[model samples]
Target: MPVPWPSGSICEAGVEQGIASKSRLVDVVLDESIGRSTPDVEHERAVAIFDLIEENRFCPVGDEGGGPYRLRLSLAESRLVFQVSREDGAAVVTHILSLTPFRRIVKDYFLICESYYQAIRSATPSQIEAIDMGRRGLHNEGSQTLMDRLAGKVEVDFDTARRLFTLICVLHWRG
Candidate 1:
């Protein structure tokens, strides 16, 4: 099935051209952090992120980690917050982004993506068929606004960003 933008193709392309893509990074980290509780909690966090994405493609958008700054991820139409920072020698993603009343950029964009994602995932067999019918149908439609919102929300290091985007594409294309 056709996947969403910035999914597999974008990530693959990004890797070739040196861009920040999500899927690539997630795979590397998860591969490195699979079984044991190693010295790098960041790698573990990456695995957890993969788990979360697999379980639910939608998450709230907000300051998930809480401190002066906010770290977050966008899936579907929701923004998942992460208590992230570059310290020691790894990138840390802590906490799931929550639903807050405030209108933060990360959160808002995530919500949009989450909405589209939910609509796609919740589609029945008939609905899926309908969406697949034509270019303007659900499957063929694209969300530029969502993509615009997604801009900069994925600011993790190169590898992590690529991996995350890759996973997002997988979720979007899941049948």
Candidate 2:
């Protein structure tokens, strides 16, 4: 569920509704306040953000006039924050979502990823493939969950959801 947008926000539109491909995010930022990440996590974050910006369909539910928007993602007060703004630095809206729903899946995905990484060094090709398959399955499942959670709020395609899910997991990463 979405928390109310901050007061004095520039949301002339009513409560979030509708999905349109009229807007796309041109920038994605992670909170600097968040702790540092491992090299692997950093690489994942970079790749995810690059892919998301390269091609994505992200239209904030009620924002009109379309985007070229900028998204600043952060975790604060135990919630996930999506601070969206115009290219010229105008506030569009901020969406704060609960992190409880994603905890279990994120944990499981991390476990599988660790297993896959470990297997890469000594396991046979088939064994590595098996671990990779499981990791991808978990990643896909988490992405679907993210899409469901963002439904009616943010319009994003499956590939976009996958990349966003990676970023979300990155927020939880303690490395």
lDDT of 2 by residue, 5-71 (tens): 3343333133243322235688998888666789987887888889888876676776776666899
Q: Give the candidate number with the greatest lDDT.
A: 2
- The alpha-carbon lDDT assigned to residue 78 of candidate 1 equals 47
TM-score of predicted structure 1? 0.25
lDDT of 1 at 13: 46
TM-score of each: 0.25, 0.81
Clashes of each: 29, 0
Clashes of 1: 29
Worst 10 residues of 2 by lDDT: 12-21
